[model samples]
Target: MRLTRTILAFALLAAVAPIALAQSQVEITSDVFVMNEAARQAEFEGNVMVVHPNVTVWAPKVVATYGEGGTTDIRTFEASGGNVRLKTADQDATGERAVFTPGDQLLRLTGNVKVTNASGTVDASELVVNLETNVSTFTSTGGGRVTGIFTSQ
Candidate 1:
């Protein structure tokens, strides 16, 4: 009886171990640029790309906010005249200005935003994506357009 109980406990532990060890999300690449060490304020420039399980982001400049613990708290990412591309398992988006909130897992893009998926493409002046809910919202300023392309595979 004792051996059987021990085996059951071990099996339960093994099953739960993986779930506990798994991270909420993952990041692919990051580049941080610091102006002054004493200030702890920095700008991340260059091809700052991040690939999560369901989304990706590309930005040129990202302003970082640090906490007293010397760690990052928030980041305001921006890309002007450049492009910000995002992709997931089922959808994709591109835009000019991309703002990301790492702590909240939110992304907002403005200026000629385009989203494409298995169904079609949506074009708007502004776009917002919530990673936690996997939902996206598109808004337009003045004029907006949505184009759909269908190709048989």
Candidate 2:
């Protein structure tokens, strides 16, 4: 019975270990941080930076709106200030403004958006990324055209 219990305990631990490690929390830092509980919003300004497991964001200002669950259940994140940038393990992107909707797993960047990766670089007036599907779409408005420079690697 003792040996059987030991084996079962090890199996349980192995099963739960991955889940614990996967729940990496996001961290944000900036020169100023403000929370408005009444509005269910939090704002970071002056060289705001956010670090997550998959990506990092840098901007002059970022505002996060939470659902009823508060900060843990963020609904939307908006970043603005002429030079918003995001960096991932494989790519980097910059734009004048960026908005992320967690529920839809969508990120939208507008105003002179540029994305660069090992494969190529693309420039557009707007960019939409579907985080869940790992797909990105770019578009140019006001009678402009999307441009890209790709290099074979």
lDDT by residue for model 1 (1-153), tens: 667544533332222111112333534344654443355444556776654444556676544444454432323334443677767688777888776665576778887888888767778888877867878787888765544566555
Candidate 1 segments whose C-alpha is farther than 4 A from its true place: 1-32, 35-39, 75-81, 102-105, 145-153
lDDT string, candidate 2, 108-150, tens digits: 9999999999999999999998877979899999999999999
Q: Which stretch of 10 consecutive residues in model 2 shows the poorest summed lDDT?
A: 12-21
* Candidate 1 colliding pairs: none
The segments of candidate 2 whose C-alpha lies over 4 angstroms from its true place after superposition are 1-22
Question: What alpha-carbon RMSD in Å does predicted model 1 have with respect to the real structure?
Answer: 12.3
| TM-score (C-alpha) between model 2 and the true structure | 0.82
